[model samples]
Target: MAQVLEFKLPDLGEGLTEAEIVRWLVQVGDVVTVDQPVVEVETAKAMVEVPCPYGGVVTARYGEEGSELPVGAPLLTVAVGEPSAEPEGSGNVLVGYGTQAPAARRRRVRSAPAGTAAGTGPADRTAAPRNGHAVQPAAAPATAHARVTAPAAARPQATAPAPAEGPVPVISPLVRKLARDNGLDLRQLAGSGPDGLILRADVEGALLTGTAPARTAEETVVRTPVAPAAGDGTRIPLKGVRGAVADKLSRSRREIPDATCWVDADATELMRARAAMNAAGGPKISVLAMLARICTAALARFPELNSYVDTEAREVVRLDHVHLGFAAQTERGLVVPVVRDAHARDTESLTAEFARLTESARGGTLTPGELTGGTFTLNNYGVFGVDGSTPIINHPEAAMLGVGRIVPRPWVHEGELAVRQVVQLSLTFDHRVCDGGTAGGFLRYVADCVEQPAVLLRTM
Candidate 1:
């Protein structure tokens, strides 16, 4: 018997719990090999290609293009295990915990017999092909839990410690498939197995006692979320990159007691220094890199702003290393790609790293590893032709420095009024980390470095 296996959305780590399907690469009925890219998804401002592990015929796909899917929602199902062959899988498509080959056991599959009506509702989930013959959602099963998958052999292994908590703590693919086919959300059922593990008996019991509600088989097997049609004048979905950005900013606003400080400085010296550095002919340095270097120097002096507040432990976590994040606006969306260690890098290194990250951001190829664990953020809204902005802190970071356009405006240079390269700098910091004095001190030091690039030498 050909066994059909479901592939759910894997966790696109670093706190990203959902992704929007951007495109579909395979169709139902298409025979696929192990580790083939099956779909394109955008999560946390990055586009990632999801690969299927099993080499088999695609049986069904879930979700439509532009639809959102949670971490553990079903992505697709594949029919493997041909009459005589044992199908192979790599299980390395996801980052961690490579899933192994499916159990080779001959546990009976309970599909309906010929001429008998297939029991309707979730129990009979079918695969719909793409290409208009039938529709397969680019955005499949958006949103759900991220659970660890344990093989059948491992499933029966007795537990020694207390039951681990979080997400769906269930075993038995047979039971899970049963629930999915019957339109039962595994999360809703109470597991009577060890440590709240959901067992086959519990699910069957729920169905028999009318405890779990199931949809009819005629209902769509996969979730096909409807997006607004062109010119339909509907509210734009706050999903994918947009949704992730909104959530981070909203959380920063809600939890952070923030304050903003701004000052206009004669960036004439900073620009001149950059020009000189380029004239000397190495890989040219960017003004943003200069500013980032200054920020790192300033952060070293005033480390208070480089730390975030721990609400649970009620402690202020001060980080020794600097993982600097810079805001890059690309066609995909605004993504903040982080430099591993900003404090240690020179301007040349910063410039190169910034260029690399910007290119990746534009291509939507940045990984979660490149986008998270930031100590502070640098927002260069200057390219947008703006003067300044009170930037929202990229939580759970303590601060963000906003840079405005560098224009030749009339400024007091030395003691005379002159048309010089001047730029506005704004710092938005969490109030819990430090007072206005410390924040003001950090900003003033940054301004000093911008006015006279040599001022950075003091801290360097």
Candidate 2:
């Protein structure tokens, strides 16, 4: 006899409460090894492949694809210790496993009478049958006859009659929100999903057809405003990376009293210095890395900008090491990947670290640790071709430095009018951590370094 074991979804870290099932890697009856990925789930952070801890034959899967399941919900059940020989699990931590183990012996439940499986109670439907036996309802002859005679349009219409009682069949909270946002009532629509499970498509279809009821004045007033539409206006849920960014930025605006100070720096020398370094070449250093190196030097001179305020303790905690975070925009969203101990690394090392972290950010493989713990941020919005922006401070951090494009502009060099490569640098600092004078001194030092790269050598 095979012992069936239930595997629940493990905690994927970073306080994730739930994950949406994106795809199923394994199916029922498929033999799987320990730590083999069974399903790919999308948390608010990233897409993660969840692995099974026990090696066995997959018996049943719980949630449907696109359905969100809370942590600790049963993901799938496996039959272990079968007659067929299979290797045991290696007991490695993939995500993180639950402490509870499956029962040593399987409990037998009373089977529903034949032909009544469709009408069976929820408890009977949810319980797994002994020995991996499938509990299927017998086909109803009358239902088949009615379906064959009904027209295609009539069939869908008839199948989806309004529910008389009980809760709605919708499973995803997102689907519910979508319906509520569009003023579609869940009780009226027929679900196209398995066992009348209302899906997002069902609600969307009702909206497109104008079948969804119009919202009352009160409902319309309460509904959140939708994003600007180009064509038919597709709504993207702000749940994953986009949602996190929204929440953090909103909080930063609410809590931090930040001020911005900017200076136009002559970056011709910095650009020339970069060209000389790359020409002397081993690994070609990027302009962003050079700016990051300058940032660390300036922070060393003005440590107040490189600190955070601890509200709970009522103290300004100045950090000893510089954990530099740089903003990188990818298809997922804008993510700040932190470079640990950046103050200690040389320009070459900084370039390499930036390249590695940027690659990880683009690939969406950055861990929560890499995405956090920054004393200061260096945002190079120059890549976007913008001149300048008063950027928001990444919350809890004291300040952020924004860099604009370096372009040749006419300037007076040594009392002679000439063209020089110029860049605009802006520093947004938390007012609580420092006053205008301290912030001005920090920006002036950065500008001096940009104008004459030799100033960084003194710190070096």
**Which regions of candidate 1 fall more than 4 Å away from where they truly are?**
1-3, 81-88, 96-233
Model 1: per-residue Cα lDDT over 345-413, one tens digit each: 999999999999988888888887788889999999999999989999999999999999999999877
lDDT of 2 by residue, 243-285 (tens): 7888889999999999999999999999999999999959999
The true-versus-predicted C-alpha distance at residue 426 of model 1, in Å, is: 0.9
User: Using Cα atoms with residue i matched to residue i, what is each candidate's TM-score against the true structure?
Assistant: 0.71, 0.76
TM-score of candidate 1 against the unseen true structure? 0.71
Q: Give the Cα lDDT of each candidate.
A: 0.74, 0.76
Candidate 2 yields a Cα-based lDDT of 0.76
